[model samples]
Target: MNNSFSPRTGSPQAGSQQVGSQQVGRLYGVGVGPGDPELMTVKAIRTIAACPVVAYFCKRGTKGHARRIASDAITAEHEELPMVYPVTVELPPDHPDYGRQIEAFFDESAERIAVHLAAGRSVAALNEGDPFFYGSFMHLFLRLASRFPTEVIPGVTSMVSSASLLPRPLMLRDDVLSVIPGTLDEESLVRTLRHTDAAVVMKLGQNLPKVRRAIAAAGLADRAWYVERASMAEQRVLPFAEAPDTAPYFSQIVIPGEGKRG
Candidate 1:
């Protein structure tokens, strides 16, 4: 990948005459890494610094975490757009149609972003982890990639960072490391955990207790260490026995004992 920082210019659409002398704009999905600014890659920082507008996902009534992660790297003059996603108990494909609602929100957000792109302004949508790894910014990319020139800058993932915080290796020798979403059903969890020597269970908010039970039942709980908000100022790392039932969604459990290369 070309990591050089160069100004990108393009017209809004084919046959669309340029208004005044402004150039066309591009959309960038820049991963800000897990919480710590120092963890952000040099390429990500340069992209944010150069983009004319910065967009980030946030809960409807809460502050934007991604934006905060990239604040120091961005100049005050850069435009900030907080794209809000409603946080509710509505289940997917249910009454309020969670999927529909979120899809609509992404579409609308893309339209708003298109306005900036049309003006030839480069916009960078900040993501917490690798843009393509379960990050909300991927929704925007799906919606706008066909219509505009889009680029993704990958960032350090929390799972890897969390593993690094440990005293032991996540995977060893020929051991496999499975990264599973804690939302999986009990049976699925058992099957996956039984096969992998090491595993990183993410999205451990409301489903933490369930995951904890699954790991324990699978005889892997003792090997796991839970890390919440890894790399952040308020980071917490504890054994599975001590992890709280109400850990945040950002929490992850790393099982190191199962895999030792040395």
Candidate 2:
């Protein structure tokens, strides 16, 4: 091959400057919505369907929540990538290796996504809730944003979805709504729940017992309403005081606002 000039074009340039810039693939972190496919925004559907590749986070051997919610838009033609977590509750969140293991998993997942981006293939990652709100997709977005083109499409969060099931309004006048995770310590949970106008406690799996106790201690037991699987077909709604022996991973406990903004 010639050292530096385009033989056919006869131009005095380094391979004709690569004949314009190469097409770069766009990376989209799309929030698939709480649970129901109907809740998925039109923009989300278009963005997801436009991408040639779709990626989602899932437990080992499982298809994942977001993937299931967005199945209507994703066809068999699109390549699916499942970013399985290296560790879940098996190791405590406080463990030193816990962070390391998760960090490694995200790092590897980002690399895998990057490969597709480099290949000029658009990729969309499906997230259950809003992608920016405490979602696993943020880790990958932060890693790849600086290096490639990335966009985030918002989705309905479980906080509002769970609130919709209640007869009372989540907020009335100047009421504030606070969302807390069940992973918080009992003392912290009580403190936060006691001060908030309305509260939604999420990530309720094995932490249901502790969260139930915290809601009682915070004096919001009667006000609190427990919702399991917000928009799914098997959704369950009940009083927080009646928390069952077992709750699924997607449960939410909501305390509707009392309209005390006056």
Candidate 3:
């Protein structure tokens, strides 16, 4: 793995040259939906099925959640590209080396994907949930979209899936929704919760206790719902107060809006 990766800003394929069927291999950001294979869109399925190259992100030695979601649809002949993160939470966010390490990883990954794109071999990067919503696929897209033809396929997000588990709507007319991650500081978390009509707090893995306190301080603890692995078979839904001390990375706290039209 070369740490110093720099590719020239020139398309390998001529504007008129075609690879498989098109001038260049277009990159497809395919959203495989939240946990469920059935929830994948028809276009996503078709695009993935048509592509020979499929890429996904995962922790080292583990299969990607996005790839697992699309496992049923994948064929034996598809070339798998596992873009494993070189470092995850191993260094402080403010550390200069942290930024450098991540940037190097993305640059290398982009260059690797660009090879397929330049050769006209279409590549589909599978993403769990909606690709644009806090997705790692966006990193590759930012580096490759301008140079290669790219398309994004939308799918069901966990926020919406969790909302469906309840009897009421996530929001009604004029209801504002705030989506926050528990990674924020306690004070900031409290402020965001207090100001929002409805809040969906994600990344509650180790932040559940803090997030719970923030919800209580913001005076929405009773109105909040703790949902884990939404839409999955092992899903669990509970009131915020009743939720366990710990939660998985996929868990979330949904604070319903007070606004409901009569």
lDDT tens digits, residues 194-253, model 2? 888998888888788999889889889889898988898989999876778667878889
lDDT value, candidate 3, whole model: 0.84
- Model 2 lDDT, full chain set: 0.84
Model 3: residue 204 alpha-carbon error in angstroms? 1.6
TM-score of each: 0.86, 0.88, 0.88
Q: Candidate 1: where are CA atoms >4 Å away?
A: 1-23, 89-96, 257-262
- Measured on C-alpha atoms, candidate 1 has an lDDT of 0.81
TM-score winner between candidates 1 and 2: 2
Q: Once model 2 is optimally superposed onto the true structure by TM-score, how far is the C-alpha of residue 179 displaced, in angstroms?
A: 0.8
Tell me the lDDT of model 3 at 234.
92
Off by over 4 Å in 2: 1-22, 89-92
lDDT of 2 at 199: 88
Query: lDDT tens digits, residues 72-171, model 3?
Result: 8789979999999877768876798989998999999999999988877878899889989988789998999878777777778988988778766788
